[model samples]
Target: MTESHPHPLFAHGTLLDPQVQAALFGRTVPTTPASLTGHTAGPLEIADGSRNLRREFGGTVEGAVLHLTERELAAADAHAGDDFARRRVLLGSGEPAWAHLDARPLRPAARIVIVGDSIAYGRCDPQGGWAAHLAAAHIASNETGHRVFNLAIPGSTLADVAAQTPPLLAPRHPDTLVVAAGINDSAELLAAPDTTRDNLSHLADRLTPLAATALRHNARMVVVGPAWLDETRLDDYEGLRFTTARALALRAALRAWCEDNHIDFIDLWEPLRDRPHLFVDGVHPTPDGHKELFRHLST
Candidate 1:
């Protein structure tokens, strides 16, 4: 293989197995001993209830560099599946090579069900929203059997989410339940500034039952707070006016409720606060915004 044409892949674990190599490539390709610095490999759960090596910071992973053709590279990607994502890294031999690293925190395959409002449903983004981006990542990687189900409605409120969840959970019974709501509820902010705290309290109250339902199903729950909004575009949504202050208040309430309930909380307010370009109409995120949301969720 010519140096410029074929690709070099660093194989630390299963890829080094002869049987696995033959099965994936139809033949064993040439390999040279290699080592990757600043990473340590450890057993991590993968899809199909199997274990795979997950790389972490602070050590070295002993492996080999396998030369592969374009076809073989594609096959290697398929073989890597959802457990890992291919990244170019400089090896100990001073050569840049592709290496498969943990795609997300190493965990067993799971069914993640997302419930919320339009943002969760992918409103302004042509590529869908954050949920769609998440689902696409899983599909593209094919690394794990993780499945994401987005059940967000355009104008859903906390009550709407609570009302719809039970029926949906009956069928999916997901391993993880993600709730991203509160933007619609913040509409009350248009009425009066004092309504901000009231809205917060109201949302906290509504979260109680919804969280109970998640606990009943024994599903790990994650609550995603509303994203930062552009006050200048609030007028675009006819009759709907919510300030960034209200959104921030709602986010704080959501965080507090999650803390009290011992559930995971993802705060979208602070992270997207300065990135106004990510929003298309103040209420919904652009495709890039959704990408950013997905990145936060993954990490």
Candidate 2:
């Protein structure tokens, strides 16, 4: 029997492409009529101060586990290349599940928690993002031997992270807690400096409490500070100039706190602040920008 005519196979991520899969494995695997059980995809929310995802309103976000054929497996391996390290996990029913992961292992046994905004969620790139890049780095190195759960939601605030963290961290018992915020706060601060200051002050207050809770559970906490803005356009909003300036001050303040609190600081501002092309607008980072940040984090 030919390899392509073997049992059914399941492909995920970029491997989902038949041509790509074929290119990798040097053969094609036929799809089977089989279906994965326990495959309900509802909005997955945890109490980890993790941000919320933009779920389909009134719809269930279902996920599936596919069964891959030998030929398909070969193809997947080829497509995955060396960067994507693969793993086979045993499901509850003793079924084998293949996961094409990155080369580095941030924490193998320890559960690592990542709480942030859209950047953590890989907003633009499906295969590339700082979080994903970080995960790949971890898997490749096996340094900490931890698995990462990135709880980044688009349009989320630090308050949202505070609200949802407890539950998310409860189940995982994560050893490391990483937080990323600031961009949203900056824009909000730009809108109203006084109000933004008050808001951020409240956010700062929440951090101590959040950090205490995390530490009580023996989790190490880290904060990724906000990046710097292109203040050359400050004249565009005379009313907001003061606010923007204040926001810059707040970034410094946040850094001071991180230094004092022993939180990890992943600042994206200095690396790409003046580089206008790095930003999609006055906010989010471009793909190259994200890659640069990932490289910075890795280093």
Candidate 3:
């Protein structure tokens, strides 16, 4: 027999606030006084300089168990943001529940550099792209010692990123290098599929050296794949053709390369596929799209 668990969300911090609950779920959810045993909660510093709950062994953290629907649980996840990771734990009342814990470890502030194409450049969005949103969030948090640099150029390919990366390593060494390219690579896919695949391979080969250099310097490398394009509006832009199928191919190739190289990969294809309102020209994301991208990137 399979075990059945209740959809209980244990809140020890902001989730416990009635106002916050109203803001997040649009109404107050039913919550019961509860506590988690075998753990203690304390102040945990996040990238934004805000303090959240951090758990340690050998004590109990008092909180409440909220009854939420699956949709509400997702909302709770978004409310937790990138600062926390959600997991399942047993409450003192012997009920299984979800809890958000600090996601970042205590470490010195580090610099993050993003390199990519027009999407990463925040084109069509007044608030800039996802990179800009991330930077703004960090700035607002006043995360001292942390910095984000957006080195993305419009219409850039993977090869272009290879050229733009090395110059920053010497004077502006980043602790994390984010490469968010490949949508443009798929532009040629409709006409020249083999050539596009070859291009991906060549680009991966070219990036290997750069990835090696960054890894040698103790820097983490993250590769973000392409977002889904609107086929209806794809040909509208200066006769440039792109398809969702081709974008998926490129995303898969990029993911494979990242796996082979032992690097982190973020896929924007599926997340942005159904979000048509988030796109302005079907290629570049609107302000809302960029915000969505930032949410995915941060998490």
Candidate 4:
């Protein structure tokens, strides 16, 4: 028989407030006093003056253990806001529960680290970009209460994502690792069918371990295929677009890999294929287009 873990959450913060708990998960979850070892909970005397749990050697702090369903855990994650970070931890009694601790020092919130290029970076928006909008909306909607850490270097490529993302994520261990790059690898010199296919497979191989790790922690892994390009405005000026066939082939490869590995795949190509107005410069999306992408993404 498989060793079963408890369906409980360790609350060390505002979720302990009865009114807050009732509002978020519909009812105050039942709780029992508990403690976590090797850590210290704090009001920390800082910005917002909220509590933080600082890890210390051979230390322990008291909290409460509450029974929560997966649905309730997700709701609680949403309610915690960006200030807290949730992680799997073992209680003092050796039971594992998701712990919501202050992440203000090291993180803005539970993380959704997006690895991608200019399109995802929202190149046209003088404002932060699509990633910022997406992050903000995701937080606002109370989905997972996670913030997007967009590592969308303007000129990044699929090869770059494969090379850079995993090592970065291996340490931070975000709840979601969104690979939002593909078009770059399907760029000028690398746009061959064989090359696109190989790059897709290679990228998947690189992301596999990180995805596995996230899954083991009850996290999600996502792959967003390249967006559709405006055919009429194709140009040589700071570009990352391809012919329709090349774009579709790349999308197919990416979608195939995600299906094979059971990773959540967001297909931007098909939805935006005929929507040329969404593109501001044949490549990057306008803010409106970015909004559309956000709609497709969060759902």
User: Which one wins by TM-score: 2 or 4?
Assistant: 4
- What TM-score would candidate 4 get against the native? 0.57
TM-score of each: 0.61, 0.55, 0.61, 0.57
Put down candidate 3 lDDT per residue, 208-279, tens digits, no spaces.
876865654334567788887777778645545777877788888988887675466778776688778878
Expressed as tens digits, the lDDT of each residue in 140-216 for candidate 1 is: 66545457788889889998998889779868756567888888887754345454345556886678888767655
Arrange candidates by lDDT, descending.
1, 3, 4, 2
What is candidate 4's lDDT per residue for 1-299, written digit by digit as tens? Answer: 11133357776666677777787778877888999775666555222222676544346778888787777776766766665656556678876666665543222224577878888777888766667877787567555444557777777877676667655665555655677787766665434425333454466665666565555533455678878887567645443335666667778888887767645677776556688888887778888888777766655
Worst 10 residues of 2 by lDDT: 48-57
Give candidate 2 misplaced runs (Cα > 4 Å).
1-110, 189-197, 231-246
Give candidate 1's whole-model lDDT: 0.72
Candidate 1 accuracy as TM-score: 0.61
Clash pairs for candidate 3: 122-129
Ranking by TM-score: 1, 3, 4, 2
Pick out the ten consecutive residues of candidate 1 with the lowest summed lDDT: 48-57
Q: Which candidate leads the pack in lDDT?
A: 1
Total backbone collisions for each predicted model: 7, 36, 1, 0
Runs of candidate 3 exceeding 4 Å displacement: 1-109, 189-198
